[model samples]
Target chain A: MLALELGPVKGSAVLPTSSASGENAFRALFAAHYPFIWRQMRRLGVPESAVDDATQEVFIVAARRMSDIQPGAERSFLFGVARRVAADARRTRHARASAVSEPLGADTADEREDPEQALQGRRSQAMLHRVLDAMADDTREAFVLFELEELSRREIAELLGIPEGTAASRLRRAREEFMEIAGRMKATASRGAP
Target chain B: MKRLKDELPEESFEASLLAADAGGEPPEGPRRRALDAALRVVALGGGSALVAGKAAAAATAGAAATGGGGAAGATGAALAGWKILAVVAIVGGAAVGGAVAVTRTTDVAPSESATSSPSAPVPLARPEPAPPDTQSAAPPPMLAAPAPAPIHVDTPKVAVPSVPSTVPSSAPVFDLAGEVRAIDRARAALAGRDTGETLAALDDYDRRYPAGSLAREAAVLRVEALALRGDHAEAARRAQELLAASPEGPYRARLRKVIDGAAASSP
Candidate 1:
């Protein structure tokens, strides 16, 4: 019977000097961080349809820098990649937007087990994205890292390379803006409710 | 964590962030695409580690901020066809190669050689159907997807009753150099801007070694050649077909690139 056969590829330049172990580490990192990175990219404003590419982009960076990702900091490295990829995407969308005659596939819109719950979920996510998009870039980064990601303020500061106090202040501003938007959304919903 | 009150049960911050996407599970295509892309990067010997993560963070952010209006097509432009092809090729090769090595070790060292045919050297991680409950222990997000089906061919199972094994002795190891030579010749034709020559070279390569290792690279070249010949209609249609077939395949990105470039440059 005809079967596809495969075997060890040697002398290939892609094989890093410390490949076996490095590859294992890379695979582990990919598994653990993929979903989180996917979500983070979406939250950071990569279109949902493009999240897979963005996630791959992050890991693509990671694979190249396997040795450089300090053991405990894979998340940080990945989040950072998501951040850059998202920013780049945003610029692209703004640039050739006129040229983009059609909206992208966006996130998959599969019917969920619970239709109402899914509707609510979509609304919340839409609002959340709106709120985040409205916030200043630095403030959004701080808020996302500190609150959504549950990283400590100190960690946010370290991650964003801002001072502890600067991170703290951005968090404060982000929260205020978030609540302001939330209040407005609630008011709109209530007005429509009666 | 409470960014907004009354947000837990009905409007879970996490669920909104981490719900099962509308797509259900991650589509099977991109993993292969991603793997292919990664391999291409490795193949290019381009300082494999992603542009020094630390440096990339700083440099990319600054570049984006300044790139402004012109930064629109930066992504497709940044990763040229060859670089992407190289990365995906490496990852694809690695997956196939890893499976072979693993199977070889298992076959030679073990006693029950009857499980898989001696002649039918198994592909990487042949997947046995895992027990249903076995995967229950994993977290919800963990189930987004498993490794590419090809990579998981690790488990020896009934090799599909097929036509027969026609692989040559050296077929086990992919002839990457030869693959590279083929790609280089096509690329040369492409560079020389001889659309007919480029198309001919790509077609000849595909016909000669239908299952040769660099099949995707050949596809990328074909799509690119079609575009160069201003056969944008056929190019786009072919690319879309290939994309639907392998959405996450490494060649998809370059295929998309050629399609996008044609669109952008056209009236």
Candidate 2:
């Protein structure tokens, strides 16, 4: 006879046979993917504050659709939900930057390795932020989800409801635009350097 | 774009790329709390769907009983049952589809303080500590006491009648299933660090069933709620009471962590 492993199972151990069990499974799945869903929402152009609303909306859909989701496709399903939630948030003009850009005071800079490098880092970040701000919504989203989010073209296509080839092309166009903007900012900074 | 990507050292870009892939860290401060609250809403929707489905099923069964035809009625009833199932499936399916569509088009930016005001106040409660000895064979201290059962503060009086004595003449009545669900909801809310909904649910439970057997558990949860709301003084007092009431409570360690975390984060 085969021996069963004594350790606790990770992921969904109970089948969603009943509506209640299905709901529980859905909650477990959402909790497990909370960070991923949040990140995807951010990259898609959701603002930091509204990310919660978007995330909640995504899970609400997941709960309702628990029966339709394939047993093994929970992660992909969530990403799908996240993509839709992010899109809805975008429509409402609720997309915002994450909180990392909050201006830290000079006193908080005590741990820097070198002041010059730190200052340069801030400048570069500012320039990058500006460039990101200027990109069209689709191009920006494609680039962020592809490059920053590291999602494959196929995944991006599914999430955005576009063809894989379209996702790749959009990513390329976005990268080109981002580079052109960044180049101008860098040259301008070099010329003005003391 | 190439130059910009190159301008930053590969390491920093790589770090950011990794963080982005990991969805970055949880939003800090109020944003994090808000996100947590949103997640609880999602979890609640899941529970709600189940309830709705059950209601739909019951309605369909009642409809079947009223109209009995020959063999045709049996076939019609079967078809109706299938139709009900289909409707449930479609509603749930559409919800998931909607969520995906929303996530795709949204542009995530940090909201201006003005726009984000409504979402910030929602996640104020912390999670309640789990009962001690949940994992081990040892029963919880409350279970051993054999004392008078506490009244459920939240339940309707008609649904759950009051017991004449602390030790009821009948068997000990415990809604283990509902308690389990409440516990799960509480934990989910806590994990998101959403204090508002967490506290609301706890308070709702208290009102619905005034003398709940889990009153001590709810009291322990109150401390976490106070802590999350930045009421450290109140949190400490409640934590002390919890410890005093159940010195060997399983959740002592976790409660201490909550206290420490609250202290560290205090301005």
Q: What lDDT score is found at residue B41 in candidate 2?
A: 28
Residue-level lDDT of model 1, residues B1-267, one tens digit each, is 344233435454333432322323454455544544443323232223222332233234323422231221233133222111122222222211121110001212111111111112111011123321221121001000011222332213312112111223322222223343355456556555566887787787776656654455567567767776778878777888777766654344456665676677679
lDDT of 1 by residue, A98-184 (tens): 575432211213332232343355655665665566567777777666556666665565455456788788888887776665455
lDDT of 2 by residue, B143-206 (tens): 1000010111112331221221122222112222233235434433543456787677677666
Residue A46 Cα positional deviation in candidate 1, in Å, after optimal superposition:
1.5
* lDDT measured at residue A149 in model 2 versus the true structure, 0 to 100: 59
Question: What does DockQ come to for candidate 2?
Answer: 0.06
Off by over 4 Å in 2: A1-19, A67-77, A80-129, A185-194, B1-23, B27-267
| Angstrom error at residue B226, model 1 | 21
Displacement of the residue B141 alpha carbon in candidate 2, Å: 42
Clashes of 2: 67
Off by over 4 Å in 1: A1-18, A67-72, A94-119, A186-194, B1-36, B43-267
Q: Please give the lDDT score at residue A51 for candidate 2.
A: 60
